[model samples]
Target: METAQNQQQAVCGKEALDLLNCVAQSPYDQEKCVALLQSLRQCVLNKKVKKFSLAEPHKEQADSSMIWSKTETWKWSTKLSH
Candidate 1:
């Protein structure tokens, strides 16, 4: 069976791939690119919103879940930074 560590690594890899795809699909669309990154960032921010250090340890993992939002994601990122 795959361990937690393996699962974490898989999540990380997927996030990286997703980010690459996001950029690849919108090469010339600044808004789309920004939106993609912001959405990814939001997934990270939501999980660690309780912390004040702005440190996201399992950010990639949390962001890779199927429940990830495509909309209002940037707004969540804003919540993390604030």
Candidate 2:
């Protein structure tokens, strides 16, 4: 499912700022909204491009370089032939 943030163009970072403002004034969900805004801010500071811009697709060059391994492969003797 696409989040409201992921569905938009990230126009001038306005959506993020708007979320923060809304959270400040919110009654029932103020904590949740504030937490999300803080998390967004932290992601950007961490240089986490994936979290920074969810709408953008992954770059093939970067994706191709990453190595992934499932935990079962290392713990168990079983290995798929194909």
How well does each candidate superpose onto the true structure, as a TM-score? Answer: 0.35, 0.28
Residue 43: error of model 1 in Å?
0.6
Give candidate 1 regions above 4 Å deviation. 1-16, 49-82
For residues 1-82, could you state the per-residue lDDT of candidate 2 as single tens digits? Answer: 9785344323224435556456656375877777767765664455433332222223332212211123321111111122
**RMSD (CA, angstroms), candidate 2:** 17.0
Query: Among all windows of ten consecutive residues in candidate 2, which has the lowest summed lDDT?
Result: 72-81
Q: Considering summed lDDT, which 10 consecutive residues are worst modelled in model 1? A: 72-81
lDDT measured at residue 5 in model 1 versus the true structure, 0 to 100: 50
RMSD of each predicted structure:
11.2, 17.0
Q: What number of clashing residue pairs does each candidate have, in the order they appear?
A: 0, 0
lDDT of 1 at 23: 69
